[model samples]
Target: MQSRTGARWEEFLGRLDRRLVSLGLVLFTLPPLVGKWVLPLTASSPSRALQAAVEAIPPEKLVFISSDWDAGTQAESRPQLTAIVRHLLKQKRKFVLFSVNSPTGPQIAQTTVEKAIKEEDLTEEQWKYGRDWANLGYKVANTPWIRTLSRSIQEAMKEDWQNTPISELEILKGVDRWGPDGQVAMLIDVTGSATIEYWYAYLTPTKVKLGLACTGVMAPEQYPYLDSGQLSGMLTGMKGAAEYFELIGAPSPELRVTMAGQSFAHLYIVLLILLGNVPIFLGWWQRRQR
Candidate 1:
């Protein structure tokens, strides 16, 4: 009878229906995603520094945004781009958008720009295309191509994304080249890959300040660049995007929901860890009492 009871107890403790577990997880996680529960996040130094660097950009020269991420990394990269672009637009700064890493990056960036513009509620007269910004589209960013780009923007990109002559774009009027003495004030590369390495290797000496917004997995390797002054600033990942939102004084409801869901999921994992170990611990304690 003792052995049978033990078997019954084991069955109760050791087996859980998979569907029930799935349902429990969904129930546990969905509220935070759907509601306003958000974990408070303080802006880190890197995020702070990035915001300051962007703020310090001269109004006359244009900002070059190398939107180099595709849909795969949009979860992090899109927020980062939106935050920075929104800030730029709010400041009435002119910038050029393009992609060198992914073909779809430019399209994603264009969408992000439109979203920012709509959020700002700016009219066509206030923020018209070809005057405020231009999308130069995607290009092959090989070392030689980057080298040429560092020298002459006109030579590297002859036409805009719509196939219009770049020469006619009012935004690119004086932007014939890139460097400290040239038209672009700064270059911020938002990417998931090591595409920044091309710029770091080939275009580092031009005194055109570089910024990076990269995925979490790709962040650690680039910190040395920030510390060494090769990077003006950086946004590390989704957390970085949240911190940026804080700095800009615009809380993102979607990001808040996402972070809260992540926090609850982490708590669930901790709960699982405790549950998995408590039985063994209790067994050890009972044996010791014997």
Candidate 2:
């Protein structure tokens, strides 16, 4: 009778342990996906600053987006791009996209924009491709291309990515080489490369406001630019993506639930670790008493 009772207790505890870990992980991850409201995390300063800057822009002004990221860093870049695009479309801001790296950069940018538009339920009129935005596509090779663009956008980009004349694009009609009136409203760089440094050296000097979104590993490296005021705002990674989602008050099902689950899971793990350690400590205390 005593052995049976012990076995039952052990089985119960083992089952409970597994359930607690599973429940904790679910609780930690689920809110970011299904929750009606999430108290926004205050730790993501860069995303907050970026969203504030985007909100401050006039609805009519055109924003320039340089998406130099590809499949290699899609996990970070995709969400950042989605958040930015959603915000821009919501605010009715016009934008132009170009890439300094990989030939496939334009495709990735296009897909991201399209996905955001669909997800946000924005209309063609709200975020049209040719009129509200233009794609200069992959123009030149890396840093030199950025320098050329800084010197003369028109001369540097004689034709649109699709071989259309830049002059023919309604979005680019106001942009010129000389003054602020024709200048880009804001410049966004989403890249894994050092292309951002080139932008700071050449483009930011022109007084073009800049924002950045890079991978998780690159966040530390990007702080110098933010500190110097070269980058007006930034989004570091998926966490930054979630922060932006919070700011926009438009969390996707997956993100909200996942974040909640992650939080709960962390809590559960900490509890288990503490419980496990306490038993070991108690055992040591009892042995010492003997």
Candidate 3:
């Protein structure tokens, strides 16, 4: 009778374990993808700094953007790029975007721009390309390419990606000119690599204020620069992107869903960790020795 009762209890625990694992999977998977729950969102220190940096740009000053991310980091970097770009476009600030990180960076950037514009409920007549902003396209050989930009902006970027002469583009006409009195006011690098170090090494001397938007894994490498004042501000991964969306009062459910999924996934992991140690604490196998 005693043996039968013990076997039943063991079977029950086994069933409970399987159920818990299934529940964890469901918790982790659905929240970000389809969750409609309205959870509280608090912007982090870095997220706030990024918002402040973008807002501080005077209307007449031009912004230099280095878009260096590809699809692999699209989840985090894309939303961040979108939010920041929307803010810039809404503020009527002209910006020049280029990339040195990946060959496909330009195309990715173009798609993000379209998404941001679509969200604003504006028509092309209101925000035409090469008028409000321009894409310089991707350049090769990171270090030397960045150096070329700092040395002679016109020489490095003579034509927009559309092959239109940069001199003729309304947005680029007087900004980052070849001569000493250049108008490029700031640079924000949205990358998935170590390009921030290169930006600081090559572009800082030009007196262009620098900011960063990078993957969560790469963010730790940038805080030192932030501390030293080389980088004015930054945003990390999708968490950072969502924080920006919150700051700008974005109504994008897509971003909110992703953040919600991430939160639940973390909690599910913690539960798993606790469940994994249950057998050790209960001494289930240890008692078999008797």
Candidate 2 local lDDT, 89-172, one digit each (tens): 778788888998768999889888888888878776776777888888896665676678887788788777788999899888
Root-mean-square deviation (CA) per prediction: 4.0, 6.9, 5.3
Give RMSD (Å) of candidate 1 vs. truth.
4.0
**Which TM-score value belongs to model 2?**
0.73
Q: How does model 3 fare in lDDT?
A: 0.79
TM-score of each: 0.85, 0.73, 0.82
RMSD of 2: 6.9
**Candidate number achieving the greatest TM-score relative to the actual structure:** 1
Per residue, candidate 1 scores C-alpha lDDT tens digits across 210-249 of 9899998898999899999999889988888888988988
lDDT of 1 at 50: 89
Question: How good is model 1 by TM-score?
Answer: 0.85
Better of 2 and 3 by lDDT: 3
Positional deviation of residue 266's Cα in model 2 after best superposition, in angstroms: 10
Q: Between candidates 1 and 2, which one is better according to lDDT?
A: 1
